[model samples]
Each structure stands twice: as structure tokens, then as C-alpha cells.
Target: MAHIPAHSDPARQGAPTTSSRYELLTLGDELLLGLTANAHLTWIGAQLGRRGVQLQRNVTVTDEADAIAAQFRESWARADVVITTGGLGPTCDDRTREVLAAVLGQKLVFDPRTEEAIRARFAKFQRVPTANNLKQAYRFERGEVLPNANGTAPGLWVEQEGKLLIMLPGPPNELQPMFTEQVIPRLAARGKLSDQEAYIQIRSIGIGESALETMFECTFSRSPGLGIAFCAHQGQVDCRISSPDGRYGMEKLRAIASECAALLGDNLLCFGHDSIAQVVADQLKQQGRTLAVAEASTGGMLANAFADLCGACKFFQGGIVSTSNEAKMLMLECPECLLKQHGAVSPECAVAMASGVAEKLGADYGLAITGFSGPCTGGGENPLGSIYIGLHSPHGDWAKQLTYPGPRAAVKQRAINDAIDWLRREVLKETHRIAAPQVN
Candidate 1:
């Protein structure tokens, strides 16, 4: 048995600094093969960050016994706490259970309480527990059980030589509640956290990565305990900051955020974790306004985004996918001659679409997106990834033309993000204003 020490300093007071390290290990062939998005990593990272725990490394391995055991040993050596997800199911490839037994020099013993919980869960579904289900009742020797109210799998928490190893089920519903209920209390009691860490995400649009990095040159260079990272996608940059001490960190975050807000000006969409769609919906809700959309190049993605939110049906009004010029002319009331003159991907066409949809749907505002998202289609001279977005509101009709160089899916996302930014500016009515497009 490899010996590891348990938490040495469980009792500390007044948020005095104590260093605590963390590592995440995900076990599943599906994760290694990239069959499904690793949703757990982001959720776990955010959850721990809120509690001042910084996960240093995230490792993913297939369901191979040797590979799993090796990662376990390496992670335990480096970090005080290690969290593993997946490989706990009843299937044959579930290797976490046996590997833990081998590495810890212990045997898996059936725990009757776990069996009772599993049986009770099955009873609710009007089914009997099969013999195979008993495998879930087994726990590592001297391990504590994490009851899962949502599922049959019970999580395991173990400690040796002072280090903590928590094995959680892969499914979010099971893992989330268990961690919240059983794991958080134990972790908070560790008293291993060095300084109370503070994390904040500042989301902005219309700023390039190089520009943001250059602006923060001295800021990042000087702060030793402060960590900073930037993620750019769909025409926005997410600026993340981590500070060691909570009070001092929050003060620094506020000052730096104020400077960023001033520098980015209208380009800054929001501070914190709000999505562009959510921001737009919040503004619309505040103003008690409504919206409708007409999409061609982007399909109905704009509509779908609004639909994802609650109370959308009340304010979203409706939308039309006028893919063909005939629908644009007949359904949206755009003049046929305009389609012939400017083509579907032109700013003039976008304006017409927006203006027509707003009138057709009897909405306060209308948005239209048109573009060539991919390589030239049907031998047209229009450049690929050229997008034009139009907005018609009580004030006036406006359009913005941007040439984004990316693949098909990326172009559509950029268009949607830009459109959302336009909405944000209109609702706020401060900062830089998008000029109305010229109508022929």
C-alpha cells in the first residue's frame, strides 16, 4: 500500500494563508476519443474557483487500468486533493474500482447501506435490483460513501497519509449534488487554502487579443500572485483573473476592471459571466420592448438562442427564415427589384429584410442577418465569410458590414455575436453608436 498523509492542519482561523493544491482526472474512452464535449471540466473548475480552490492540472485518460492507476499516483504526489470522474459504472470497462483496490492494497467490500440506498432507488421505479447492481454497493476499504439521490451510483471519498481522493460519478446530475452535499463540507474543513482566492470573468466584444494583452502589459507583469488568461471566440474575448487574497483581490479586480471598462468603452459588452444572449434579453426585459428576426445565412440560430431563455415567448414575437429570394419578396415584402439589384448578401438586402420583418410581425424591433458563410456558392463573386447584419427599430434602420475570415460554422457564430452586440448598444444607448446603412 502506498501511504499518503491526511490533512495535517484541519483547524485554522481568520482566513490565514495555507496552500492547497488540486488536480482533476477524468477517466473514460469517450473523453479521450473526443466523442462528447467534456462538460464536467468547466463546471468543476468554476465551482471550485468560487470556493477559492484553483485546479492546477486537468488530465484525461482512457478506461485502461494501468493508465488510471499511474495518473492517480502522479496526481497524488503533486496535489493535496485529486478528483476523478467516470469509470464507476456497472459496465465491464469500469476499471476505477479494481485499480483503487490494487493500488491501495485493499479489497472492495459490499457496504449494506449503499445496497439499501440502491434498492430504495429501484423501488421508486417499480423494479427489483438485479444481481449486477450489487457491484455498485461496494466501497473501498475504510472509505466514506457519497450518497447520490439522483442515481444508483454512490461516490467514494478516501484519505491516506493526509491527502484526499474523491471519486465521483461522471454524470453531472449525480456528481453535482453529491459534491455539493458531501464533498464541499469536507473540503472547506481542510483549512489548506493559502489565501482566499477570488476569480472574475470580464467578457468583451470588438477587442482583439493582441490589443487586450498590450493594454495589460504592466498589470500582469507586476502582480505575482495574480493570474490572468484570455479566451477569444465568436467575436468576443473573455478575460479571466485570479487573485490570492479575497479582500485585496476583489479591490484589485474592481480597480483593474474600471480601467478596462474605460479603455474598451463601447467595445466592452459586460463584466462577469453573462452570455451575449442573456445580456440582450436582460436589456430588452428592462426596457419592456419586443423583437423579431429574419435570418438567411445564419438559419434560425438567432431564434433558437432566444427560445433557450425563460419568458422568451412573450417578447421574442416571431421570426422567419427567408432563405430564398422569393420568400424574402413575398413573406417579408421586400421589393423583387431590390433583390435583383443588390443580391441576397448585400447590405441593402439586409436592411430590406429587417424593415419588412418588423412590419410583418408588428414588432418594436427587427433584426436580419445575411451572408456567404462558406466558400463561394454557385460561382458568385461575393467573398466567402462576408456578413451583413441589419436592425430596424423605432429610431431608424441600421446595418453593419464585416468580413470575417473563418470556416462556415465560425462565421455564423461571429455574425450572431455581432448582432447581439448591436442590440446591447441600442438598449444601453451609451458608448459608440452603429450608424444607419445607406438605402438606395
Candidate 2:
């Protein structure tokens, strides 16, 4: 927690302003129905945050002309700047240009440059331009065309009555670079922001939102300009802080976060963006430590997840898919006596499996995941989705039991997420944990 800074004093607000905050409207039915993810929003947010411009609000609508027009009109009143994505194409469904022109009370005018660019792009693709494609040249009065190097839908930047409207293609590849190179510089030139800011994100595991919130109550609201927000998903929490006018606010936030984390302690996970496995791998790479894994119900999923991350080969010693009791005995040297006595899903088997992999692979650290992912299971005490994760380090060996409710795939996914989360928490520095307020 740190002192969150207030918006500069109103008296000081009269000073030079660098940028005007805008409302973002993303238009498309695919977004609402989850057919297409709204990655454009995330990309723009990150890009703008880097430039000290805060996107105040976001609204999403389908490509219907009336609906789009209504939202644009409403947003215009509240926001001096509005950016619309999608519905700028030539298809009949792409009515963004028409709706926006209507909202501005202007007639659609054709631009020669836009038409030429569309023609040239089509020529590059070796296709004849249809009459429908001519719609790409449409523009409103005093509107400027934003060339799309990646696509035919050139973006539009229009100015009217001291308000600015920008329309960009919906595809992320086109939208991101165009905004950065063309739009961001223009907005920066307008002087909406006073100073730049620095941000650091801390990734944590084994901590729930409420617990983190309650513990950091004292420090949470302490800063005037600094901010700390907890973004939680799939049992992992990201604590992020951003501040303008330098690191004073950032440092304070980090200090308070550290203290609160120290109180809450280990299993808090990594402090930065890297995962537990990543942190471990980095440490292993630096210290020359090797690793291995023996998995059962997880079916080598953990190893697969690690593989997705780059630089894994530097420290990942190997992994064993010991799905069957026979594989466990033959590959990892898990004794039959242990399996029969304690069973596959038991803590004893998990520990033995980790140790077996470590010794068999001759690695410094060994990890094992043994669980019952099933519709039914043999163990009378253990039902479906009963899991145990094992960790074997030079110091000692440990195992934890986790019972989650879900279908087979969901349970497995949760197990893997939890496993990675726990690993991250264990390796990171201990910090006080914040516990959020409880509801009755």
C-alpha cells in the first residue's frame, strides 16, 4: 500500500494541460457474444497508460446503426474525445462511418487518397475492387484518413467543435501500431498530461482478494497520486501500482506492499510478472540448479505449461508422464509397497514420486503432481477431483492436498493453475498479505 495522490489541486489544474481523456467505444456483436475477445481494449489501455493518458470509460455495442449512433451521441457529451473500433469495413454490416457521420451532422464525403489506398491494397492482393469496396473511401467533413498498412480499412481521425474522434480498424495488428505511431503522437501534441508515470506489477499466488484487501487497509488508501489495484483470475492475483511525478509514490506503495506481504508471508508468490516456475528456472539458471517432474492425473500438463514460456530448456532437466502405476514404478522408481499402502493420490506417493524423479533424473529439484481426475475413483475416502502436489528440494520434501469441484477438464486446469501459483508464492520474497473486507 502507498499514499494515493489526489488529482492535482484545482488551482494548479489551471496550469498547462497536455491531453484530454476519452471514452472508448468498441463496436461489434462478436465482442458481446465472446466470439471475439476485446484485445483491442487491453492493447490500447496499455499503450495509453505508458503515455500517461487514462482512458476514463469503455462502452461496447453491436454494429447496428441506431445503437452505434446513440452511444456515439451520448459519449460525445461526456467525452471530448471518442474512439470507435470495428464497423469501418465496406460490408453492409460495417455502418460505423455512416452512424458517426450522422452523429456529427455531416455528410459522408469520398477521399481520393483513401480510395487510392484501397485500390492499391486490393491490387497487392491481386483482386479487383468491387463497388462495395469503394465504401472504404467514405469520410466526413474535415476528417483525415489513417492509412492501414496491414488492412484496407484506413482509420479516420476527425476534429469538430474542439472535440476529436478517431476510428481505427478492429484487428489488433493494424489498430495497435497505427495508434502508437499516428494517434498517440497527435494526442501528445495536444498537451493533455502534465507528467509521465512509472508502473510496477507484482504477481502473487496463494492469496485471495478479500484477504489481501483487509490486510492492506491502512496502506491501501495512503497515497494521494499512487494507486494499487488487485486483478485476480484463476486463483492468481496481480498487484499493480502506477504513479506520476516519479517513484516517490511508487516506492511508498512498494514499501507498504512489502510490509503487508511480510506479515502475510511466503506462499505469497513472485513479486514481478514471472511465474513460479519462471522464477525457479531463473534461479536455477543462475545457480546451476536442475529440475524434473513426475505427473499422473495432470498428465504432464505442468511440463507443457512450462514449455510455453521461453528459456525453459536452460533449467528444465526433464519430465515423466507416470500416468499408470506401472509407469510410476518403471520410470520414476516409485515402490509398489508405497502405492499399495498409501495409494496413488496420497501424500506419501506424491513425495516419493518427486524424490524418485529427482534421483532418477539427477536433478537438483523434483516436482510431482498426483491426483484423481475422474468421474469415479477407487479410494473410498477420496472422491473425484482430489489432488496432491509434491515438491522436493535439497532442504526437504513437502506435499499439499487440494479438493476442487468441477468437471474433469476444469478440475485439471484448476489444479495446474494452483500448482503454478503455489510454486511462485513459495519462491518469492515474503511480504505482508492484505485481507479484503468481509461481507455478511
Model 2 segments beyond 4 Å from truth?
Answer: 1-19, 106-131, 137-141, 180-182, 192-203, 219-231, 238-251, 267-305, 310-370, 373-379, 392-398, 407-410, 425-440
Model 2 lDDT per residue over 1-440, tens place: 22223333322221123347678999999999999999878877766655456688999998788899898999998887898899988898999998889878888898999889888988997998999989989888778888899888989999998989999989888888888889988887777444443355566567788777776676756756555678887676777665554435444555655766675555455564556567666656765667788889988788887776688887787789988899999998889999999888889998999899999989878888898888666377677889998888776788999998878888888888876655544433221222345569
Question: CA lDDT of each candidate?
Answer: 0.79, 0.76
Return the TM-score for each candidate structure: 0.82, 0.72
lDDT tens digits by residue: candidate 1, 113-159: 99999999999999998887788889988788888899988899988
For candidate 1, the 10 contiguous residues with the lowest summed lDDT are 1-10
Q: Each candidate's root-mean-square deviation in Å? A: 7.7, 7.6
